[model samples]
Target: MSKQELPIIDASGPGTACCAPLACKPLSETEAAELAPLFKAIADPVRLRLLSLIACHEGGETCVCDLTAAFDLTPPTISHHLKVLKQAGLIDSERRGTWVYYWINPEVLTRMSALISPASPAPTGTA
Candidate 1:
């Protein structure tokens, strides 16, 4: 990959199409590689549910304590899932004193939504 190509997740530099809906256009190899990790991060059932929980939480954020109760998995396992989300830029976190809080990165979610959503068909002339 050239200098312009970088992983979309967490990449703040130029040439990162973080907002371009996939349905609107086909992905280049660089774009595909960049987005694959983000998809993989949420591929797990637990991780997907965890993301939904956080995204749907009141005030757009949730505490680690609050999240642990929602699943049978241990705290460490949950934390690991959160870590993957964070790494993929699907979510962000902040430590509030003793508790850690997580919130969805709406931009990323919007991008994802746009990606899967079907775009309007282009106009064409017919005989």
Candidate 2:
């Protein structure tokens, strides 16, 4: 099969940073629709591991060659997973000579973390 370049969403779009935590407020229709694909992209076991590997790689980025070594799958299979991540905006990549280097998009990770983070505890003592 041929390699395909999927459209990348701008994770910095409106409402991404302003939304309340999941425990504090239900996701608005737009928010859910926007985020579902991202979550889905990471839902796959291989992709999730690939995301974690890229996030934890030294220097905050790694080459496709390194990623392929971590799994038993073929390079093309690994590339497919990486492509899915890139499509979801959870990761970004650049071609360097014969290799592609990948890195986590920190802003998107921060937004995702904030969305799932628990709300602060209520004050124990009333004013």
Report the lDDT tens digits of candidate 1 across residue range 16-65: 33433565457778778877876898899999999999988989999999
- Against the true structure, what is each candidate's TM-score? 0.75, 0.75
Regions more than 4 Å wrong, model 1: 1-25, 121-127
CA lDDT of 52 in candidate 1? Answer: 96
Worst 10 residues of 1 by lDDT: 118-127
Write the residue-wise lDDT of candidate 2 on 35-120 in tens digits.
Answer: 77777888899998998999999999999988899999998999898888887778888888897899998766666665665553
Candidate 2: clashing pairs of residues: none
Q: Candidate 1: what lDDT?
A: 0.74
Relative to the true structure, candidate 2 reaches a TM of 0.75
